[model samples]
Target: MKRWMQHIMPPGTKCMCIVAIVVHLDFQSRGIGTALVREGTNQADQDEVLCWVQSSEAGRRCFENEGFEEKERLEVDLDKFARGLEGLEERDAERKWGTHVWKYMVKFPRQVD
Candidate 1:
């Protein structure tokens, strides 16, 4: 196990996962999200880690700007997911985050000398 970890992990890297990345609604359209993600990727670069994120459209834009690449995309039909919700029509479902999924992405940041 120790040998396995050493071989797979770079010098300073460890197991790291970013389950969620959200900037405040008030901070939207600003560069806050990009900065946050850039910092995260920068750290990953130093640690020799490859970072992953499941990003929505806007979130996708942020990561993409920072050089993340899409590995996969998943879309959910809310009508199927919601089944029998009284007020959520298929069209209405389009308007909610509850109906969508991210394109899986990974980022490899440049190593600083």
Candidate 2:
């Protein structure tokens, strides 16, 4: 099945090509997320750029185990951020779904000299 990241990625960043990972929900706790992360890091091993991802709270441990660091925390004020929008737009989609999204960034830091 087609996933959200499959369509929204910044081009050339799929599977083992780019240094990013986008995991699916149903397959999350079964090591699929870790494998995807490993693939990104494997790519980073050969490429100049580092591997990076934004994961949910539940996925933090898998990423941390694979050597990803928490770069920063992200917060969004849906109501404020969604201001000046018409009814039932992308901004209002979250309200309809009744869940706010939070992301913890995971990055394979560049080696320091």
Candidate 3:
């Protein structure tokens, strides 16, 4: 759960640290991932910032359980992405990708003082 600080600074604000947590696949569903996220969030203190991630349904469920909500979404029409492509052209990439999931989601802490 090492957080990589990219030092992205907005106007009149402190730099933010982008957290990229890596939990082992073998340890899935054993609370390891949840624990890692909790520990990572515990590191934040008095910094006006944001944290985001791109995840699956299962991952989204986990984040939701931790009080995350869908703030933004982009419906990528695979047809547009493959409009002029050769192989797999006619196929609707959105349908192929299962309900057109969003690759990025942003979330903030529920507890704010």
Candidate 4:
């Protein structure tokens, strides 16, 4: 939807990109993640900025539930990516490796500026 956004978003609109959000394993299922993202969107709405994020699977779900839309995707071999992290300690479960897909999600303003 990157193309769509570029086409639809009015001229001179600003965007706020969320790098990431990590909730502890023990704190999963609580609304903290959603709340944090929601606050970002709310502020963006009031300030007329477009909210954006690059989210993982669970993060995509949370943002999507809060009305974020998928705009783009970057699929890669997470194993290779992890392997490139030289000298970094890793666990045995494929060392956080798999078909890693980074999703670009966004929340547009109610009315484009």
Candidate 5:
């Protein structure tokens, strides 16, 4: 967690990090990802803890829709990792390997009345 996150989650506040959520290709765009995030948020709310996740591009929207806000981002170049690997030339041509972005997002527990 970054120092600024202290403002969102005061010192000693309990926190939870959701590492990953993956939906099958055939099942995507059907709200499954949103449902998963909702479940996590619900649990965090019940426990009164802040919830967070490092989300890929595909998962960013789901997390956002679940009330998570982007706090930080990390970008990695795929081409650098794939360098000197055979057969990547053709694949690179097809997709144009580029930077992959990961966003660190957080959602504070909803306040109770």
Candidate 6:
């Protein structure tokens, strides 16, 4: 867990954390992720608990569409972590390595009518 998570959700807080949501490459961009998030959000709403997720760049839009607000962002340098690895140069020649961003997001439970 990250520091911001602790700040937002202290011990014993009534909250739900979405650890991961993965869609197959062939199934991506087809509302699957959004549906998954919606289901989770609906559950949280029913339970009257806060919902949280750590979203990747690819999943940010989906999470946002599902009503998750960006609370914080973490940027990691992939190149730095990959430095001195065997065949890195060859891999870099084929593709570029740069920063990867993770967005910390939260959605409060919606009030029922």
lDDT of each: 0.72, 0.57, 0.51, 0.77, 0.83, 0.86
Q: TM-score-based ranking, best first?
A: 6, 5, 4, 1, 3, 2
How well does model 1 score by local distance difference test?
Answer: 0.72
Model 2 poorest 10 in a row by lDDT = 1-10
Q: Estimate, for each residue in 7-89, the C-alpha lDDT of model 6 and write its tens digit.
A: 88877879999999999999998889889889989999999999999889888889899889999888997866775654666
lDDT order of candidates, best first?
Answer: 6, 5, 4, 1, 2, 3
Query: Which tens-of-lDDT digit does each residue in 12-108 have in candidate 5?
Result: 8899889879899999999998998898899899888999888898888899999999988889988777756546666467555668998888998
Give me the candidate number with maximum lDDT: 6
Name the regions of candidate 5 deviating beyond 4 angstroms: 1-11, 85-96
Off-target runs (Cα >4 Å) in candidate 4 are 1-11, 81-96, 111-113
* Predictions: Cα RMSD each: 6.0, 9.2, 6.6, 5.7, 3.6, 2.9
Q: Select the stronger candidate by TM-score from 1 and 2.
A: 1
lDDT of 2: 0.57
Deviating ranges (above 4 Å) for candidate 1 = 1-15, 85-99
Least accurate 10 contiguous residues by lDDT in model 3: 1-10
Q: Write the per-residue lDDT of candidate 2 for residues 1-113, one digit (tens) a residue.
A: 13434533456653322334556776667888778777667666656454555666666787787887666555555555554444677755755433355454445435544
Which residue pairs in model 1 clash with each other?
none
Which residue runs of candidate 2 sit more than 4 Å off their true CA positions? 1-26, 79-101, 104-106, 109-113
